[model samples]
Target: MNEGLKVFLAVADERSFTRAASKLHMTQPAVSQHIRSLELDLGAHLIERNNRMIRLTRAGEIVDRHARQIVQTEEQMRRLVHDLASTIFGALHIGASYSIGEYILPVMLADFSKKHPGVDPHIEIGNTHSIASMVASRTLDVGLVEGSYSPNEVETEVLGADELILVARNGHPLVRDSFVTIAEAEKECWIVREEGSGTREFSDRFLEDHHISPERTMTFSSTQAIKEAVRSGLGISVLSALTLQMELELGVLQQIRLEGLPITRQLFIVTQPSAFQPKVVSAFSDFAKEHFSDLTQTRTPVHRTSIDET
Candidate 1:
């Protein structure tokens, strides 16, 4: 029945037996046979036949809807069964934006692997917009992104809060003082994340709020590239302080507090609200919340500058 439904869907979508047969990698005779068997089982013709065109009958439309639901449910059932057997033993598909994926998730994933040796984790890294789209479309089991998502089909939870700081190479002119006003910060050249990045989105919103724009800016897709560029005195950038912890320790980069700028943003874990979540995903989500909660709680606040300081 599943196979029959698959064949039916292909034919219905293509509106041609020959095309459906090619798509399904089946002979035209086999495709026709499946449709015939389906009609026999239901005791009704499913497709309206014509020499040049094929259309779905009223019954076919209903069956097509049911077929899609059936397929989706079956896949969900398989995932659930695999999860129940031992969530720690299945593959977990996760997507994340560049900053979180590169700077934060590695430590979390490493800890997860050590704790759950049976679970295999595969990660896909992209921009926040792409990661959110993947989660909404069920292409990814889960995603970690910075900032908020507006997609109605996806559910989101805040994983942690991070501050974006204006950073520069050690001894750079911008680092002369512990704090600078937004107007002063905007006068410097900037190395910024590319568009569509959650980091970039937050940075843009913060700048717009302060009525300041960078005099010059260079865009980089990778945070590593941006960091290195800033280290080389190419320009300054606004980035999550967590990403620069090692750089700050090594004296490679210095954080510059900026007045009248809201540098804080939330990290989110997003997934399709209606999709069946595998147990592996559920367990990972729990682990992330537990570990990240402790980390965020114990962390000291970054250099704070009041908006009135400007």
Candidate 2:
């Protein structure tokens, strides 16, 4: 009944059979069959269906709670079995913010895979906020983010500090003097990362601190897109120094020093606090925490996590 429980949970959570089927990649009829089969096995109606609406019965509510726990427990059992046999095994789902996911994670993931070949990593890259949300919802086993997250919902540990840089195309007038005044910086067109981006958060803070408001602004969801826009002389942007290494080395883009600029952001590893932390997840988190400094090529102390603690 593993599939049945999963189907029920999806239906109950989505409150729409069509949406749940699309989410699970199953047919609408198949989803209905699973629910019907579940009700028959339990001898009770699980949900009340009216037209396009669905609501769980009292029995369904209890099953929903227990089913979630059962699914989590079953995954823990599988991972534990694999760990006892091979020390580590199974897929590890990891979420990361754009900068770390693109320029940082591949390096660490490569090394982690070399040492633990049995673990397959599935990575989803997004902004810091979204990544943290997924970790809290248990969709992602672990997350590497550059922004702040809720302390009450998820456990976090500082992985490292990422340096933010102000970048413009080479020969831009703003950097002619090797430094930009607040007034000069405010006059130029600014390109920023999309809403909810950690890089954008720092950029916004910088503008607020300097009291510099731009006359024009452009927003892009992708870091690379923003970089390209900056390169083509669309507008200057604030981005992670790690993402600018190649362009800086190539003389295509230059880092500009605004007075009291160059903000630093803390990188964090976020995980859901739970009683049972699979060996695979713990091992990967430990590995990433210890090796995060390599991303910045700095020697510094690392913090530890207590996610597995009861």
Candidate 3:
């Protein structure tokens, strides 16, 4: 019945069933049937027809004013529904690489939750590569990672910068010289994150660029495990400065300043294109970016070399 009203309104506006049919993508007979149904429901003759032209009867003129209002109401209702879905409340599934998830996101999420208590945020931690794949598949609504993402498949914005540096157990021989040369650093054994991790990606690029290869490499699936292994004197590892804040303060692990060190990489916020983005995702993403912008301005810079060196 409502569809019949809409068709009749179209027909009335167009002043021809054939034109209305063309506009509505329906056959002329279908348009006439809709008008007939509308007329039967109203118990009035809405249109008077000649051989090739039609005019609205008095009843239709009355109905036409009301029909326009009804159509406008429907449009407003649709917009309200869309607005509620986008901004009000829903579960937000977020994916992040281990470095960002463990070291960066907890505080951000806590702050966000305080402001939007109705929104439930659940996080999945993985390597950057895996997290990017999840975003592409629509499994994760948003992603924060420290590695590169394909601009073609996923939309990315720079979140911030993460500074990478080398770490070893306190009092390791490498730190005695204040700075180790690339060739000298390569001779040491290394404990590192797995191949797909963002840290590993940076480390691999850094190594290849400088032509440094460790004598042996031990892989760990997690940042915590790598930190522990490095603390126990298994070997030195390259890690985000953000992750080593507590350890550096506690003196459990010491940074080994390498010549030309502190590789800075851009952290990224990733999502599907705007067409695919949900309301909650856009809200949170904007909130986070604004919050981090203020934070970056006020926050003291992390020393590129050892804390004591600064």
Candidate 4:
């Protein structure tokens, strides 16, 4: 019945058996059979299949709503059982923005994996706004993001601080100076992240505040790409301090001190405001906070000039 309900929901959502089959990795005939079996068991027509698309009947509408609830309840029950048994074995879905996912999360995940070897972790990386949206929709169990999100849709906890610093090639003309003023900074070419990036949002707001509309020569979606471009002297960019560690040490890039720069923002752990959180999700969140807490305490204090919203 659970399987049938799943098939029904997929079909209902897709409005096409073929598409649902593709989504479920099943044959079209198999999907039809599952829907048929479900209708037979219920003794009512659950769906109306037209030549073009499918629509749910009145009974199907009620069934669909109840079916979703049943699936959610089943997941909750499984989580509760695992928690009561003191077992840490389950699949966890996590989403993260590029900054945290690329630079910060690997070590934390490695440590968590070692302690909870039974857990299976799946991570999806996207921009902060997109990742937060996924968490709000419950598509991901939890999300780590570097930007500001709506408080109404999801609950957020400050994970740590990220310092946005301007970086350029070591030999760039700007590097000769101790600090570049807003006027001097505006004369340089810039390589920035694409839209929807938390880092870009903060950088743009900072640039706007300083009234410096620098020429944007290149835009990249990933932090690594932006860093590589900067290294090649394509242009300067503002990036997270955590991301520039290896590049700085390797002399590939150097931070250009701007007179009023180095914006600081809080990284966040976002989750849906639901009453029930799976044990695995809850455990991972707590572990991440505890883990980063120690790392934060040991780090040297960075004097913050201004706080960016993201």
Reference-based TM-score of each model: 0.73, 0.77, 0.69, 0.78
Where in model 1 is the C-alpha error above 4 Å? 1-75, 85-87, 181-183, 298-301, 307-310
Worst 10 residues of 3 by lDDT: 72-81
Per-residue error for 178 in candidate 2, Å, reads 2.7
lDDT of candidate 3 at residue 151, scale 0 to 100:
85
lDDT of 2 by residue, 175-286 (tens): 6544567778878889998888889899998889878899899999989999999999998988887677788778798777676456777999999898777889999989
lDDT of 4 by residue, 96-124 (tens): 99988998789989999998998888799
Error of 3 at 206 (Å): 0.6
Which of the numbered candidates is closest to the native, going by highest TM-score? 4
Model 3: C-alpha RMSD to truth? 16.4
Clashes of 1: 0
After TM-score superposition, the amount by which residue 6's alpha carbon in candidate 3 deviates from its true location, in angstroms, is 35
lDDT of 3: 0.82
Q: With candidate 2 superimposed using the best TM-score fit, by how many Å does residue 264's alpha carbon deviate from the native? A: 1.7
TM-score of 2: 0.77
Among residues 3 or more apart in sequence or in different chains, the pairs in candidate 3 whose N, CA or C atoms overlap within 3 Å are: none
Cα lDDT of all candidates, in order? 0.83, 0.85, 0.82, 0.84
Q: Rank the candidates by TM-score, best first.
A: 4, 2, 1, 3
**After best superposition, candidate 3 residue 152: deviation in angstroms?**
0.6
Query: Lowest-scoring 10 consecutive residues by lDDT in candidate 2?
Result: 301-310
